[model samples]
Target chain A: MRALPLIPLLLGGWLALPAHAADPADARIATLFNRLAQAEREQDFQGTFVYERNGIFSTHRIWHRVQDGKVIERLLQLDGLPQEVLRVDGKTQCVSGTLVAGVGNTPDSSGRLLDPLKLMSWYDIKTVGETRVAGREVDIVSLKPRDQHRYAFELHLDKDTGLPLKSLLINDKGQLLERFQFTGLNTQAVPTEQELKPSDNCKAVAQVPPQAAEALASWRSDWVPPGFELVKSYVRKDPQTKATVSSLMYDDGLARFSVFLESLDGESVTDTRAQLGPTVAVSRHLTTPKGDMMVTVVGEIPIGTAERIALSMRAQDVQTKQ
Target chain B: MSREALQESLSAVMDNEADELELRRVLSAVDDSETRATWSRYQVARAAMHKELLLPQLDIAAAVSAALADEAAPVKASRGPWRSLGRLAVAASVTVAVLAGVRLYNQDEISGVQLAAQQSAQQGVAVPQVQGPAVLAGYSESSEQATGPMANGVLQGQAGWDNQRLPGYLRQHAQEAALKGTESALPYARAASLENR
Candidate 1:
C-alpha cells in the first residue's frame, strides 16, 4: 500500500517537476510583495536607515511611532536640506520645502492604485540567502523579471517582521541601478515624540483633499511583454506642457513602469529618449485624429521595452474614430 | 575643437557638470592621440576619469595621424620645391584646420539648434529631418534658446526655477510611486532624496 502511494508521488513529482518546487517560492514572494504593499498602509513602527546612490551616501533618521493604530511617521532629512515628511497613516500628512506639485490627484485613495498580484505572474521570485541588516538577520529575496521589459529586484526582508531591509533595482544585465537599504533598524521600542519633530525648513503642506476617484480611463498596450497587465492609468495635464498627458502604469507583478501619452496640440515635440540609472524613458511621436502626439514611457524598464510601450499606446476606439 | 572648447568640455565632464551633449561629444572624439594623451594624463592625475586603462602606445588617434603624416611625406617629396610651398601650405593648413574645427564646434554638425538636450528621454532624440517643414507644437519660435538656458548650463534667472519644473515632476513621480509603489522603499527613498536636494 505504501509503495503504491509512493509511485503516484514519484510520478506526480516527475510530471510537475519545475513549477512544483518553484510554485512555493513564487507563492512566498507573492505573499511578501502583498505584505510589502500592505506595509505602506501600516500605521505603526519607527526605524532608521541609510540611502546611497551613485555612491553619494547619506544616513537618515525616521520615526514612525503610532498611537491608537494611526500611523505618524516623521522622516527628517538627516543631512542636506533638513527636509521632512510627516505622514499620518499611509497618506502624506505634511511636508517641508515644496510638495513637488502637478500630480493631478484623482481624488480617491482607493482608486489611486496598483495591483501587486497581477504583477507576480511575470516575475520569478527566489530566496537567495541569509543576511544581516539593522542588527536583524534577514532573508534575501530576488524578484527577477521573466521578460526583458522590466528590471529585476533583490530585496532583503527583515527576518522577524518580513519588512524590507534593502531593495535593489537591477537591470536585465544584472547591474544594480539604484539601492535603498536600511543600514540600521529598530521596531521593539516606540520612538520618542521629539524624534519626530520637523526642523524650521519643514513647512506644513495642506493635505490635498482626496477628490472623487476619476473614472478608469480604459487603455490597452498595442504591445506588451506577455504577462504584463495594466496596473494603473490616468491623465494628468502637465502644467508646463499644458497638454493632457494620459498616463498608464503597468506591471508584471514584480516589475512596474508608467506610460504617459500627451496631445502635442500640434506643438513640435522632438521624439526624445533618456536613461537615468535603472529608469529608462522613451518618447515616441504618434499621430492620432486630433493631431501629432508624443507618447512617453518611464520607469525602471529597458530602453527597448519602453520604446515598444511608447509605440503601443493607442486610443481605445481608434477604429471607431469616424 | 578649438583646444580650449574641447578642454572645457572635458574638464566639465570630469567635474560631472557636463550634460549628455558634452559627454557624448567627448566620447565620440576620444580617439585623438594627443587628446588621448591628455585624457590619460588627466586620468593619471585623477582629475579626469577614462572608463578604461589607456595604453599610450596603443593610442589609435595618434597612430592614424602618424600614419597620415608618413603617407604625406612621399607625396611632398615627389612634389619637391612645389611642396616647398608645402611648408607654407602646412602653416596655412594648420590655420585652416583650427578654423574648421572651431567652425565645427560653433556650427552644429546638424543645424536648426532645435535638437533636444541629451536627456533621460524615454524615446530617443527626434529626427532633425523635418519632411513636412511643419513647426512642431510647443516649439516656442523666436526664442534663440532651444531648450532654455538649462540645456547650456546657464540659469535664466528665477526663470531657472521657472523651469526646474523637472525637479517637481521628478518629486511628484517619486512620491506618487512611493504612495503606490510595491514592496520596495526605493520609491520612498527616491522621493526622500529629491526632498534632500
Candidate 2:
C-alpha cells in the first residue's frame, strides 16, 4: 500500500516541478519595473508631492518634460524657502539655494539607469498588493534587500502609466524611514514653457574643469557588501578649507552610498556616526604612514554596513604590499 | 484550571514575579483565545500605567522562542585535561577583550547622544519667531544662517573637524547622487530636503 501511494506522489511532484521553475509572478514584477523605468523617461507630467522624514516635512511641485529625447525637470518647494532646482537631462542646471562648495563641478557624465534585471540579484522584487494613490489606481511593489546591507523600498506605481505615485523606504525593523507620496498628479497636460522656467532667484551652477586622476586612484576599499560596485569616483578641493577630498560612489543597482576620504593632517577629529532620516553617515579615523586620514561613508544604507565600509577603506599601496 | 487561579498566574507573569510553576500555568493557558485576550488587555493596562508606547502586534516572547529554537548548538572540539588550563586562559582573555570593546562602544554612544542633545538645544534657541506671512520667508532665511552649521540636521555646531567638513561632505554626496541617480525626482527631493530650514 505504501509503495502504491509513492508512485502517485512521485508523478505529482514531477508535474509540479515545471510550474515552480517558471514562476510567472517574478516575470510580471520584472516587466512592471521595466515599464517604470521607461515611464520616467517618456512620461511628461506635473505633480505635487510631500516628502516627509523624521523631524522634517515639506511639500514640493515638480514639472517633468520630455522634448527631443531629453528629460527636463524642474522642482520647487511649495513650503518654506521656495527652493527650486532645474535639471536638463538629469544634469543640474541651477538651484535657488547656495550650492555646496566644491560640488556640481564634475565633468558631465551619463546618469545611472535603473535596471530591474540587475537589481534582482540584490533585491527581491515582488508585487505585494494594490492601492489607490493620488486618485489613480496603482500597484504596490516591494523591493526587499536579500542582505541586511540596504533598506527596502515599497513603491506604488500608477496602473495606467506605471509612474511611481508613492515610494517608502523601510528599515530592517519594518519602521518607515522616509516617505514620498504624490498629493496631486496631472498626466494629461504637458508642462508648458512658463511652468518649466526656473525663477530668477535660481543661480546657474558654475562648472569647473575636472581635476587630475591620480588623487582618485590612491585609495580603495578592501571590502564592501556583496553586489555593490564602484560606479563613480572623483576628487575635489574645498575652496574654503583647502582640504582635498576624494569621493568614491558605490551602488548595488538599487541602493547607493559614497566613501569620502580626507586627510586630517594631524588634526584631532573624533570618529562619528549619525542618521539623518533615511541617510546614514559614519566616519572612522585612520592613522596612516603619511598622516591621519578620516574615512566617511554616507548614503541611504544601514548604519552597520556604512561603518563596515568606513573601516575597510585601505590605501592602494597597502594592498599591493600584501 | 480555575479561571481565578489562571488570572492570578497571568498577572504574576506580567509583573515578572512568576515562579516556575506560575509561569508554566500561564503558558499552558496561553493557547486559549480568552486567556490570550486577557493577557493582551493586561499588557495594554500595564503599558498605560507605565506611560510606554505599546506595540500590540509585537510578540517579542514568541519571536525570541522561535529564534532560540532555530539557533544551532555549539560544537565542542576534542580536548584533553592537559589543555583545559590553556583553554581557560584563552577564554579569560576573550572575556577581557569583549569587556573592553563594550566599554569603548558605550563611551561612543554616550558622546553621540550628548552631541545630539546639544545640537537640538542650540536649534531650539536659534529658531526664529514667526512675525507675519511677509517676513516668514525672510525669517526662515535668517534662521538658516543662524543655524547654518546644524542646518543640515545631522551635525553639531561645535567648532570641530566634523562641523567644518561634514556639511560639505553630505552636500557633495547628495548632489552627486542626485546627478547620477535616474530614479526620477526622489534624489532631487532628497538633495532639496537637505536645503530646507
Candidate 3:
C-alpha cells in the first residue's frame, strides 16, 4: 500500500516537471519578441546592411533616430542608383527613385504595431539556437508558419539590445529566398539630424484626400488563410489607364499580402502569375454582372496562396445577401 | 601501359566508341594525375570543336568512378528485395545530382534560351514528350521559364498585357508594404532592391 502511494507521487512529479520547463521557455520567447518590438520603437541605432535575393543584391546605409516620441529614419543605397527614402514616424516623407504613379495618393495609414501574442497563433515562435552576427552575440529565433500559406523566417536578434542583426526568409523546401544581414552596427552613437535629413534629390510624396469608405466595401474575400485580418483598404485612380483600382491589405502579424481589384473594361487579358524573389503575384480574371474584373494578389506569400486569394474575391453586395 | 596507348583509349572513351577493354584501360588510368591531365585536355579540345561552354575543372568521370567504387562492395549472399531497392535508391540519387547540375549550369542562360524555346515552341516545334532524364530536364527548363523572365535581376515581361501592368503592380505592392513599416527596414530594403533593377 505504501509503495503504491510512492508510485503515484513519482508519476505526478515527472509530468509536472515537463509542464514547468515548457512554460518558462514559452514565456522567454514571448519576452524576446516583446523586447524586439519595443527596441524598434525606442532604440536609436545606425548600421549598414546588405539585402539579397535570387536575382537582385544591394547594399544600404540606414540612420534611425527616436526623439520626442517620434521616429525619423533615412535609408540610402550605397551602390548603383543612389535610391533614398525618408520616413517620419513611419510615414514616407519623400523618395529619390521613381515609384509607381498614383502610389502616394492613398491616405497614409499609421504603421501596424507588431503583436507577438497575436503572431503566436499563425507562427510557432521559438528560440532555435544562438550565434554571432556583426561581432555581437545573438539569439536565433525561428518563426515557422503553421500552414503553407506563408514562408518561414530566421531572425538573429542582438543579445544586448534585442535588435535584429540578420534575417533570412526560407521557403517550404528549405531553400533560402532572401537574406538581410547587417555588416556593421553602432548602437552607442546616435545619428545626428544632418545625417537623417533627406537629400536635395528626394521628391516629396504627393498626398490626396482619402477615398469614400464605401469604395472598398464593394469587394470582399470569401476565404483567406486563417489568422489574417484586413488591415487597410483604399481605392486609387490610375493616372495613365484612368481605371479606379481598389486594394485591400491583409496581414497575419508577420506575413502580409495585398489583393487588388480593377475592372478590365472588356479588355481581353489572359491570367498570369509571376514570382519576384520572395514576393509572388497572381492575376486572375473574373466575369461579373457588371463586366470583367482582374483580381491580382501580390505579397511575400506562396504563389498557391496568392492564386487561392485571387479566386476567392467576390462582389461584396452579392456576398451580403446570402 | 604506354602513354600513347592510354591516350588512344582516352580518345575512344571521349568519342563514346570505346570497346570494353579500352573503357577499362581508361578507368584504371584515371587515378594517375598525368593520365587525368591528358583526359581533361582531350575534353577541352572536344568541347572547343563543338563550340560548347567548357567547364574544364569538372571531373565528373572521376567523381562518378569514385562513387561506383564505394558502392561496389556488398555481401554477395545478401541478395533480395533490399538489394534491388538499394540500386533503385542509387539511381534516384544520380538522377537528382544530374538535375541539380543542369539547373546550376542553366541559371544564367535560362532566360535567353527560354525565350527562344518559347518562340520556337509556339511555332509548332512541339517539345519532346519522352520519359526518363529528358523529361525531367525539359520539365525543369519550362518551369523555370514559367516563373517569367528575370534578366540581370530586372523583371522584364514579354511585351503584352503583363508587360503593361505587372511592374506597376509590383511597385505598388512593395511601396505599400514599405509604408506599413511593421517590420522596420525589411520591406524598405525589398522595395529598394526592386528599384536597383
Candidate 4:
C-alpha cells in the first residue's frame, strides 16, 4: 500500500523533470548566447553602429562571416586612430595598431561569459517587458542583483532569435553607466566573401597558445559582498615592457571588478584612487615579507571594498609571505 | 553605543533626523571598521525588517565628508594670483575639467599598472595628441558632475603631476568597467569617451 502511494510522487517528479519552473527561460537565454557566440565565430555580417559613453560618441564598422563552420570577424576603429582587428572564431588573426595585445593568448583580467545558472544565485531574473532595438522586437530581462554588492542590468534579447539586441548597465542610483545595442541587425542574409576580408591596414598576427602565455592560478576575492563568484583570471605580459601582469576578475553576475598585480621595477610609486562616473579604482601599497607590492583594484564597487580587497591580496607563491 | 540607542540613531540617520550629537558619534567612529560594520548591520536588519535594499557597506558618510573636505581645502588656502583666476568659473577643458575634478574623483578610488605608472597616471596625463581631447574630456566631466554645481571640480588649480595623472587614472577606471561580464554599453561609452578626449 505504501509503495502504491509513493508511485504518484515518483511519477510527478518524472513528469516535472523537463520543465523546471525556476529558470526555464534562463536556460533558453544561455543556449541563445552560446549559439550567438558560435554564430559570431562563424557567420558573416556587416553593420555600422555608434558607440557612446557619457556624451562623446563614435561610429564603428564590423564585418563578420563564417565559412564551413569557421568564423572570421573584422572590427575597425572608424574614428580617431586607424585601428582594426581581424579575428578567426573570436581569436585575433591580425591587428592594425594595438589589439589589447595577447588577448586570447594572454591571461587577462577581463571576466568571462554570463552563466545564468551562477548568476541566478546573485540576481533575480525575470522577463519584465518588451522593446525594439536594431529594428527587431526584443524581450526585456532585468537581472536585479540580490545584494547591493553589485549593480543591476537590463538586457533586451531578440524575440525571434533569442540573441541579445541591447544591454544596459545601471548603478544603485539608477544611473546608466553603459549601453551596448545593435542599432541594426540582420541574420536573414549572410555577408559576402569580400566583406569578410580585412583591409590592407590589418596587420598579420602570429597565433600563440593562451595557456603558454601565463601559468598562474586563480586569484580569489577576499571578501566578496556575497553572491559574487570567480568569473575569470589570467596573467599577461605588458606589450611594451614585456613584464608579467597578474590579473583576476570577479563578478556578482551584474557588477564586476578587476585586480591587476604587476611587479615594480625598483621604481618608487605612490598610492592612487580615482572614480569615473560609476566605476571606482583603489590602489594600496603593501609591503610583503618578500618585497613591496602595489594592489590596484578597479571596479564599480564601494570604495572601501576596493581598499579592503587591495589590502587583502596575498602573493600566490608560498615563497612570499603575506 | 547601546543596541537600542544605535538602532534609534541609525533610524534617525536614515530619516535624516539625527541630532548633531548623534551625527558626531557616527562620524567619529566611522573609521573603526567595526562601528561602520555595525551601522551596516543595523541598516541591513532594518531594511530586512522593512524589505528594502539597504546597502550599509557603502560609506556615504566618508565619501561625502571627503568630497566636502576636498572642495573646501582649496578655498581655505585663501588668496593667490591663481586663486583669483576665474577660468574655473567657466568650464575650460584643461585647467577647469581635468585638474579640478581629477584630484577629488581619484582621491576616491586606483589602477593595475606599475607603481611609477600608477603615480604617473595619478599625476601626469597628457591630451595634446588625442585629437578630440578637449571635447571628450569636457563631456566626461560634465556627465559625472550632472547632479550639482561643479565648482573647483574641473578648476581650482592643483600642481602639475597631479593634473596629468588624474585623467589617466580616470581613463583606467572606465576601461576596467568595460571589460567585465555581459555586453553593456555604458562601460563601452566610458572607454570611448576617454579615448575621445
Q: Give lDDT per model, in order.
A: 0.56, 0.74, 0.74, 0.55
Tell me the spans in candidate 1 whose CA falls farther than 4 Å from its real position.
A1-44, A104-107, A110-119, A197-220, A226-228, B1-169, B181-184, B195-197
> Compared with the true structure, what per-residue lDDT tens digits does model 4 show for residues B33-134?
667777777678778889886556677877987788888465555566565564553344355336524543444332222221322333333221111222
- How far in Å is the alpha carbon of B73 misplaced in model 4? 44
Model 4 agreement with the true structure over A1-322: per-residue lDDT tens digits? 3236545644554454344334567676566556544444444566655654344456666665667776666566678765565555444555554334344332343324566665665566677888888888888888876554566778887777566667776654455655666767667666777766778887765443454224344234445555556555556676655766666666665576777666665646556554444456665666654466656777766555676677777765533333
Q: Give the TM-score comparing model 2 with the true structure, all chains together.
A: 0.68
Candidate that scores best on TM-score = 3
The DockQ scores of all candidates, in the order shown, are 0.07, 0.16, 0.21, 0.07
**Candidate 2 global CA lDDT score:** 0.74
Total clashes in model 1, counting residue pairs 3 or more apart in sequence or in different chains: 23
The digit string of per-residue lDDT tens for model 2 on A183-289 reads: 99999999999999999988998775555365556887777876799877778778898888888889888778999999988788777655667887778898766
Native contacts recovered by model 3: 0.36
lDDT of the structure predicted as candidate 1: 0.56
Q: What's the lDDT for candidate 4?
A: 0.55
At residue A295, candidate 1 shows an lDDT of 69
- The i-RMS of every model, in angstroms, reads 9.3, 6.6, 8.1, 9.5
Highest DockQ scorer: 3
Q: Which stretches of candidate 3 lie over 4 Å from their true place?
A: A1-22, A105-108, A320-322, B1-159
